[model samples]
Target: MFKKSVLLYLLLAIGLVLAACGQSDQGSEDKSKEEETTQGNEEEKASEESGSESEEANDKEEDADFVAAYKEGKDELAKAGEGEEVDYQKVIDLYNNQLQPLVAERDGNIDQQISTALEAGKNGEMDGQVVKQIFDKLTQKVFYLTIKHEFQEIDENWGKKEEVNEEIAEAKEYYEVLKETVEKRDAAYETNMVDQIDAGFSEIEKAVENDDNLGFQLGKQVVDKTLMKTFYLAAGAVPNGYATKAAKEAEEDPDKAKVEQAEGWAFYQSISEYITKYAEEDAKIIEKNFNLETDVKELDPEAVNHAFVRGLSKVALHEYEESEEYWGEDKSAITALEGALFIDMIASDIKRMQGEDAYNTLNEQAQTYLDAVKSDEKEKAMEVLEKIEGTLNSIIEKAK
Candidate 1:
């Protein structure tokens, strides 16, 4: 009976051990299955993230292409406007062939970005941020292009009589306001300059009213000059010095002053001589209807060539005076001389092209200023500078 009881106990122990082993195996299998399922889910999530990134990258590329196209269109329009002659057909072609297409493409790109953002939002992705960024960039481009387009339109229609008339009227109104403003700023300000600007506005108005193309062209020059002056004044670009530092230095030291005064007189004399000679030559060229080929060896044989020569001469004189231990170089003088010379050249060419009478008138006015410079009177010389400026503007008008 004792042996039988021992055997039964052993059997029970064996059964319990088997049950524990089976439970362990089942738990291990379940843990392995869970790990495999988790890994598969992680891989799917990674693929989805990569796909979103790729879509975002594509959207950026399309947006970049649209911006580039718009910029290119703006540049082409600017180029067309800056041509020597406005080719209306070319402007039209550019708008039709390039600009319109770009506009359409840009619109499409905006729509696509918006649609993508909306779809992403619906899918519980980040919402509206992408659309906002695209809109911000597009708005900047559109604003800049719109301003450029307006200016191009003005340039394209500049030759039209109706457009010119409207421009002239607008200019006249602005001029009146400018005149009143100037008077308010400096009651003693030289009225001559203002009078000259007024005369320019009048000419533009008259030309447009008469429907005279040549006259209108001339009138445009006056309007352009007046506008430039208005812009300069509005921008506070007035010069700081009335005379060169060298001229000022002469006031402190008598000996140096004497020497500089003599040098200044010599410089003025040289400028006067050149002006007189050039004027005579220019008159002849105009009389010949600018048919004579220019001889560069001669001191500006043609009026058209005088601008650069005169500018260089003035710069050289200023540099020389400044280098004589009197003062540092006067950049303002150099800039002023260059600007004047440029205006003079443009005016001279226009006058010469217009006819002999116009050319002669410009030459005569220049001669008057040169003669005034020779007078050696400071006030008179300064006055002549103003007069020369006004006369040059007049020549530009007549030449047009």
Candidate 2:
């Protein structure tokens, strides 16, 4: 009986050991499968990320190519305006080959304009200079508005640092194309517009680095208003602007004056929305005065000119009001700077009408208000702000 019991115990122990070995093998196989799945998922994710990066790079390259093509087309057309013999067939072919596809992609009224202008050029129906102005200035308007659109995207994606930074970069790229236009205006007008715009862009960069939304907002306003100032200089800022040029040439050379008027209208469209925001009636009047479709002989250059002054003056007043409302805060400084920028937009006109000394005094007071707001000196800011408002109001009244 004892021998039989020992045999039974040995068999049971053997059975338990075999079961343990089976369970250990199963666990090991399961772990291997899990690790394989994890590796596969990581590889897939990496592939997707790489694809996305490749797409972004391709899109950027495409835009760069498009800008080059645009420049080539514009330059070719401008040569005709400069009295250089241009092969119309060559320009048409260039447009069809390079510009048409891209312009079609951005299809709008602008596409129609481009097509019509090119057709006219091909058929010898439009002057080359007019074609050049249309292409150059209209393309510029698109870039300016694109910069605005990018800023709106930045605002929408404010907390997403990478996304916001990307939008800012795009905005800067658009502005880069516009910098030449600003520089040209500066050369003609003897203004420090390029420096002002550069400072605004620098502020934008610094604000982004620090993740200060308000600073970014303020910086955007400066860049925006300064660009508006540049457009104003091109369109209506007296002595040298298209508005004045058109008026002076009207009696002597109606055709040339009409071209100048067209140029003024094209340039004004770039900043019309901003002006319309502050003074809709004035915007309408200005538009009517510059519109080529209107009776060119009956066009009132003075009305267009004064409307711009009134519109900008109203914008300044509105900004100062905003500054006053946001007192004791960063917003005050932002709007104050904007107000000052608008005033500076018409600085030459201000000096002309109010005299250089008065203009200087107003400029000084504006700087004081901006500084006071930044330093949190509410009393001083308010005092200077009131004076600024008074001056702006007087200017608006006179513009009427």
Candidate 3:
């Protein structure tokens, strides 16, 4: 009976071992399957990323090819000259050959349409030139459409165009009137009596207000006329000797640039006032733009030019301080500096050779001017230094 008990015990131990082995095998199999799943997911992600990269590369190549082909077509057309048409199909065929790989990569979608257009052109079965013209027209249409949308996007952009139009109109309509008014009676202007000017001085009043978009058409014409006047004014302001010389050669030889700058300022100023007056809805755009300019300071006793020029002026005035903030050390900032430190060094040398008094005076004036610029007290600083400068100028003239 004891022998039988021992054998049963042994058999039970064997059964337990077999069951444990089965569980171990199952766990191992599960681990292997999990590892395979992770590897598969990683492989799929990599494949997708690589495919996307390949697609982007192909797209870039396709765009470049298209540009090249378009340029080539243009060159060929130019060679064909005026009143002559080139073989559109021939150009299309050439472009298709260059685009084969790009189309194949895109699963032959856009490429297929291009191929069809080219083949049809080749056969001369259609006005092949029409196809090229269609594409050219589309390109121009796209550009103009983009500009139209841009004008919509920024209210300021639209205002600029509108302001330009308004100025042009005003100059053409009222410029002659003001001039004629002054011409009729120069005494009022000479005596600073601008308020006592006549309303009726120049240009014939229309007999009748015609229908058929007269206002719209007149608006455009007025803008164009204003544009011509503004052009003359701007041309006067250009410091180019060529422009100045050309003006001097003209019958009414005037400094075009100064005239133009003055006229532009007047025109823009009037437009600004008009916009502030009648264009309440549109003026909001100008206000938004005005707010966006970080450096623009609205000085109460100044005109727009002084106000407009100040934004850049202030930044320039504070550049040295701003630069210190941008770079903790001078190494980076020093590399991008754009002026002549040598000029200051030369001036220092001159002062040393002359005397302490000359150097002291130069340093004092420079320091005062720099301090004034920093303090935004330019006008006061100028008043203080004007006599000093005049004295120095006279002294130098006597020495010369």
lDDT of each: 0.35, 0.74, 0.32
RMSD of each: 35.7, 23.5, 34.2
Instruction: Write model 3 residue lDDT over 1-400, tens digit each, in one string.
Output: 0133332332232111101001111112122223358789787677766865676466446555644655575455343324366666556666556634433332232234344434443554323333343233222222222222222222222333433333233333333323332232224212221221111111111201222222222232222222222322222112221223333333342223222222222222212322333334333332322221111222111222222222211222233333233343332132112001111212322243446676566556545544454455647555644543443334333322
lDDT of 1 at 28: 21
**Per-residue lDDT tens digits of candidate 1, residues 1-400?**
0133332332222111101001111112122223358788787677766865676466446444544544443343333224332233433344345344433332333333333322332343322222222222232323223222322333345556554444344334334433543343233323244655566557656655665544443434444433333322221111211112223453465333332222222122112222333344433332222111111122111232333233323432332233222222333232233334334423323344455565465455444533443343445545545555555545433432
Model 2 lowest lDDT segment of ten? 16-25
| Highest lDDT against the true fold, candidate | 2
lDDT of 2 by residue, 2-111 (tens): 13333233222211110100111111212222335878878767776786578657756766765776788788887875689766677667767766665544335455
Give the lowest summed-lDDT range of ten residues in model 1: 16-25
Clashing pairs in 2: none
TM-score computed on alpha carbons, candidate 1: 0.24
- Provide the TM-score for each candidate, comma-separated: 0.24, 0.79, 0.22
Which residue ranges in model 2 land beyond 4 Å of their true spot?
1-41, 82-107, 123-125, 157-166, 294-300, 326-332, 375-379
lDDT ranking, best first: 2, 1, 3
